[model samples]
Each structure stands twice: as structure tokens, then as C-alpha cells.
Target chain A: MTGTEPTADETPTTRSIPAVAVVDAQTPGNVGTIARAMKNFGFEELLLVDPPELDPDGEAYGFAGHAREDVLPNAQEISFDELVSSYHTIGCTAVTNEGDHNHVRFPFSTPRDLAQRLPTVDADTAIVFGREGVGLTNDELARIDEICSIPASADYPVLNLGQAATITLYELREMTLSPAGTQLPDLERVRASQPLLERLYDQWDELLVEINHPEEKREKTARMIRRVFGRADPTTREVNTFLGVLRRATERPDQEE
Target chain B: MTGTEPTADETPTTRSIPAVAVVDAQTPGNVGTIARAMKNFGFEELLLVDPPELDPDGEAYGFAGHAREDVLPNAQEISFDELVSSYHTIGCTAVTNEGDHNHVRFPFSTPRDLAQRLPTVDADTAIVFGREGVGLTNDELARIDEICSIPASADYPVLNLGQAATITLYELREMTLSPAGTQLPDLERVRASQPLLERLYDQWDELLVEINHPEEKREKTARMIRRVFGRADPTTREVNTFLGVLRRATERPDQEE
Candidate 1:
């Protein structure tokens, strides 16, 4: 199983804590800052879905400082669908009072709590955050396994988006502390590389073009691929899964034999 | 003993992660990002060396959305000197390759490996990152134990400062995963809420106005308060610390008797 998937723990320690996934997070500054954020709490493995190689220099580094490279280097930019299919994502956003569950510790509790619960989960979890201002859509939130809320002062309850992500991570780490001596899976190797993901995606695109799907159908096909893999958050273990899917879809079932 | 110290497991679950101390990280956005960085990885204590209160809302939080608050809310802003005394602080920067022992980790290295061999270390090892632009001056780096490097591709060896911080944290987290069940300390009763922080800062200015401290010193004094408590990263245990400090500093020792 890849780092994204939550395998039943051989021992509590053996369980992989869910990771922090930044989906469609477009800001370079935020990217650097988030890297620094991940590092601060020992949460490595930054997955950047659907972003360009960022400008190495900007005002954003003021916070990332020494961490710029760490965050930058580990960051993997992929398609939105890749993010959706690749991860068992737990997306966080500010909820209004109408939400019934004000206090479920899963997402809002603490980093430590989240970590503890990870082993219990059946699939992988990647925490997705939306771009600033336009928080995750209902569609996006619906895709998540569970929704979490941080209890904030009722008045200005919404946390700055990145801050919310950071808080969830913070709480997750706090919750993760326990059952030591559990062998952590090696530092997860992210998707092969941008070039690799780009090539693979391109290969699929070529096939899609050939299928001669209707103009309106093209977008739907792309979106479908995006959704299935977005939740997958692929790791070395899943190379075969994609290879198989790509082989079948591209070659056509008739050609597989 | 305080924040960023690598205290031997009082909590059975917390693996020893390297501590990162900000030696005068002046940018408000940087501060917030750093705090968020820590939270993302499940770290609580962020030690700031002498920073301003209500550090102007730089892009740090706006980008962070909810996370920007961590720089203010969860940060333990302290003096560089106090942090050094409190933990194993490596006071250096990778400003230029010649100046720093920059062992760039472009490929990757665990932050814990660096943590184990940290310079002039205490159990609580702190890697002190400096203020903007001019990193820790040679004078500051000298006090450090040993310089650690985030191995980078030889080409772009120097990471943007904040990115450097992000990378460092990422590496460290790779090494140390706290044993599960390590709980975070609860928030101090009198957290410097946005309003609280804003009001206190302004009131302190007025008080300084009353005392007629130098106009220049007014900002400096306000900054000092922010630095000290912010570094403290106060929890429920810290309410009295704020009140007590305020009582003594504002009212005058002479008046207390």
C-alpha cells in the first residue's frame, strides 16, 4: 500500500498517519509557507496537485526561509483528478452554525487525535484545502470521507485558509503520538516527477483525442479521470495500478488480448 | 523546558524532533507561516526572537487564509538570547555557500539525522533561523554548535529563506514521528485574541504615550511585548504569566508595594 492508503495497523505504530495534501493550492508563497508548515510539525510528503514549477524567489519565502527548498523540492504538482483519486482526503473549511456537528475531534480535535485515528481508517486520507476566499465547494466537501471543524470564536470563526490547514495538521500530530516502535513506512516517494506525470497525462490525452468523444464529452472524460485518481494520491506501490489502467484505457479492451 | 526544547519523553509518544527557533524573524507573514508550518506537522511551540506585536498583515496570512493566525495565535515569540539559553540552538544561516556549511539536501535527508548531531545541543535542540534578508550574522552563527545543511541541487543551492525553513521542517518530520498519544497543552485562558492583541498593543502605546517613552521606543517597546509572549506560545497555564507580566511592567514595581 502507498503512503496515502491507511493499511490496517500490524501494530498501532505500524499505521501510516494520514498525510496533508494541498489540492489546487495555487499560491507559490502559500506553497513555500505550507512546506515550512509541514516541516514544523514533521509532516513531510507535500503533494502539489495541478500547479506549475513555482518561482523560487518571492516575498513568500520570508516565512519559508530555510524551508523553501524542503517544501519546494518535495512538492509534487499533479492534476486535480490525480489529487482526488490518489488520496483519502480529509478537507477542512470553516462551517456555519447550521452545521450539526460542532465538535467532532476527527478533523478539528488536534493533530495528535487525527494521527491516532488514521490507523483505524480503511483508506488513505489527504487533507485538501481550497484557494483563499473561495473555500471548498459543497461538491468538494462531499467527496471527503468526513468533515472537520475547528472551534473558533463565534464571531470571526473562519480561519485564514492556510491557518485552518495548519491547525488540522497540528492537531493531527498531537493525536498521532502513541504506540511507538511502530515502524514508519519509509519516507514516501511522491509521484515520479512532474515530467513523468505530465508525460503519462499527455499519453492519456492523446488517446482521449482519438476516441473522438463529442466536444462536450471531452471535459467529462477529463473530469472523470481526475476524480478517481484524485483520491488515490499514488505512491510507489500504486505504479502498477496506473500502468494497468492506462494500458487498458489507451489500448482499448479489444487490444488488451 | 519551554517551547522548542526537545524534552525527553514526558509524553511517551513524542519522538524527539529537532526544534526550530526564529532568531528575529521580523516579517509578520513569515511568523504566521512558520507557526502554520509547525501546526501542519503537529508542532505547538514556535520561538520567535524579538518580533513586533500585530506584525502587519503581510501576504503570509492572506495566503494562509485560516493558517495565518498561527503566526500570531500559536507562536511563542521570544528573545533570541532566551531561546538559545532554553534549547540547543544552532545559530547560523545558509545565506551564501561560502559563508554557510550548506550541505544542500536537494535529494533529501532526514531532519532527525541533523537533530542528533546538532551543534552545542541540549536535549531540546533549536535551529535558530534569523530575520529577513541578512540572515544570522556571522556573529550569531558563531554561537551555534554546528551548521547543518539542507542538501540542494548544486545549481540553486541557496533556498529562499522561508523556503529554507519549510525544507528543514520537512526533513526533520521525515525523521521524527512522535509516539502516538502525545497531547498538546491546552490554550492559555487569556490567549491574545485578535481583538485582545490589537487592544493591548494600542493601549500599551497609549501607556507609553502617558509615560512619554521616546517616540521611536514606543514601537520598540510594543514589539518587545509581542516577542516575549508570542514566543511563550501560552496555553491555559499561561494566563497568569500575561497578567503578572502586565501588572509588574505596566503598574511599576514601586506601585505594587
Candidate 2:
């Protein structure tokens, strides 16, 4: 989305990604920051739901920087009912602790999990961010289909409105962009299967016994090895190579040096 | 990191995670919001690098809410060179374009990428954020080891300081908290090797041909299938099962039901 100031020749286009809607936000800084975040994450639609009057030329634009025309100018003012009807509503809440299990906002999806689920959602969706001091009213949250929250330190879970929007949008953008290009290979590489790992472990155990590993420390040593290799999740090929090395190392003295 | 205000009896502990530092941030609101972001991401250390005098009783504490003690009271003031020597400095910059490639901040790592690398970095690390208007100066950036930027729309590259911190710290926290306790098993599950994927593709192509998929759309259809399955990255078991199903589906009427 270009942040160019709108001219008579230009027309707005609707975006396919989830639209961002802030409900009753109090500050221009937050509004501007939200706009900037939407642009940063390649999202264009913004709905100002019952927000205080925002001046495009003032703090809103000042904070929005280049997103002033693309995101801020195009932001629509919509009613709560309109928001509910136009898209599958996702309410955002900070109340995600076990204490809130009975609360309406319980079982909240973290932003990353929500992002992965968003693209598969068949309809237009809106992620509703609540106000600064107090978040969404209980009544407002009741109508939401999904509750998404950023996991944070429970001691002070409150996040600035702008920060919350940025984090959520960042995750969604990360998920969306991931499939298109070089997904993190390190994170996605195939790992050795359980049977292969166990076999490798058995080979290593025999080697340890033949080497006369300190009797008292052998179990601790084996457990450490299991823990370390288990965490690594080596690939099948790697496991095979390691097993080959172990076989040679453990072979009797009759084997050639 | 708990958000509780620190008391005289409670001692602060040094954290292994990167410390957040702000240089010449103009607004108290920005400082408060940054503190809130830090707390939200479980980061404890905050450094105010030559900031204007801030009133803890005013906007900073008011906006920080529960993070007042854990973040605000513990914030330290230090000089530029002091920052450089104290930690492996990561300079924050908005200028990540190719034009700036020759510039000091070129070749910046995205926040997510940086987060992945942070855990292995052996030293105290500080992610230094710049002023609200201009980010870190080129001279200041020169002394830093890594430049980390959030990927965003080129139209409005500027992000509110607080939002930037929130997004960067959120990514780091996500990566840090990940791989502990129930990580996404579906996402982390080892995938089938390339040879298996190719075999499955060959089987699917034959099935598509058998189903009388139109000639003109066959390549496109096959490509779409490849993309879909490629993205899913089915496991060895899943691929074997699907291939078995495809073999049955493509068999002549002589095959058993």
C-alpha cells in the first residue's frame, strides 16, 4: 500500500488480509502508530470504531509518517453492528490467565497461532483492538468469534495500544510471508524418526559399556546423551552418519586401524 | 519477569536476555510505552541513554501501569561508549533499503531473524532503540555489531518507537519461549524427505491424468498441487498413506474395493 497523499485520480482497493479495527481509542499517537503498523505489515484496511475525532494533519499524521495517506486517510468509521456483520470478528483481550478460565476471554489464541489460522478462514475477518485504559466491554467481547491475545508477563500484562497492534500485525505478516519465500529451513528440516533414534541410542549404549564407562556415572551419562540428542532432533541422514561413526569406533581390535 | 513494583527487600537479578536501551527519546509517553512493551515481552533491563529528565510520578508511571516497579525503577542511565563496552550492541535502524547498503545500517536482519540468532550469542547483548524522530545516527550505528529492522511497507517505513520495541521484543520473546514445553508438534514434526515428496508428486500426476483433468490446465493443476502439498510438508507416514490411497484410486476395475 502506497502512503502517497490521495489525489482525485486515485481509487482505493480492498485488501484480502484481516482488517484492523480499533474500538474507542483515546489517543492520536495510538491511532497513528496503528496506521504505521498496518502499513509496516502490508495491511491497508483500518476501521475506527467509535474513536474520538482524529485530525489527519496533527498527531495522527505526525505519528503515521508516510502511512498518513494510505492507511490513515482510508480508515473508515464504522458502527459496532457494521463491524460484526461485515467480517468474522476477532476480539483482542489481555485476560488470558488461568484465573480468567471462566471469563469470556479465556482460552485466547496467541497472535502467532491466530496468524496461522487466519489465512484458512473463508470469510473476511476483522481483528478488533480495544481501548487504552480498559479493553473491550464484556458485552462487546461476547459477540466475538475468536479471542486473540499477545502472551506477556502476567505481572504487568498491559501493552500500549499501538504496541499490541504492531505485535499482532507483525505475527500475521510473518505467517503470511513465510509460505511465499525462503521459510526458515532450520525450523522446518525433517528430523530422524523415533525408531531410528532409539536404535542409535542402543548402539551408543553398547559402545559406552565396552569402553568401561564409570559404572556409577553410566546412567547419568546415557540420560545426558539422550537429552542432548533428543533436543537436537537430528535428521535421518545425520543419524545414519552418526551411527556409522559409532559402529567404527566401537568395533573390536580385530578391525583395521 | 513479574510486573510487580520492586521493594527494598527484593533484589534485582541479572538476565541473560538482551537489555533494551533508548537514546534521547523525546516523550515521557514513549518511555512509559517502551517500559510497558518490555514488561509484556519478559525483558527486564532498560537503559535510558542521555534522555531528558523524566518525572516518574507523571506520564511514565501512569502509562506503565503494573510494570512501574519492574521496569521504571530499574532503568539505568548510561553513556554511548559505556553501552558499546557493556554489551554486544545491536543498533536499531529504519534505513534498511539497498541504497543504504553502502550506509552503515545496510544488510540489517529482520527482527525474527535476529531473535533466532540471539540465543547463541555469547555475551551481554543490548538492542539499542533510537530517538522518536530520527533513528540511531550513522556514527552511533557504526559501533554496533548488528542492525535489526522490522520488515514493513516501504510506503510508511517509520514505526512508533514503542511499537517498534514491542514488535522486536515480541519476536525475541516468542523465539526464546519457543522450544520449551509443548512447542507446536504439528509445525515442528519432521517432514518426509525430498525423494518421498517427488514420489508422491509423480503418483498425483498420474491420478490427475486418469481423472481427465483438461490438457491446458494440467500443468497449472499439477503446480497448484505441488504448492499445496509442498506447503503442508506431509510426514513420511502421511506421504506413504496418501500414495497408497492414490495407487488404489488410479487402479483399474479389477482392483479390490
The numbered model that scores best in TM-score is 2
- Which one wins on lDDT? 2
Tens-digit per-residue lDDT, B115-152, candidate 2: 77677544588999999889888888988877787665
Candidate 2 CAPRI-style tier: incorrect
**Predicted model with the maximum DockQ:** 2
Chain A TM per prediction:
0.54, 0.62
Q: Which 10 residues in a row give candidate 1 chain A its minimum summed lDDT?
A: A179-188
| Residue A229 CA displacement from its true place in model 2, Å | 26
Where's the lowest-lDDT run of ten residues in candidate 2 chain B?
A: B180-189
TM-score of chain A of 1: 0.54
Clashes of 1: 106
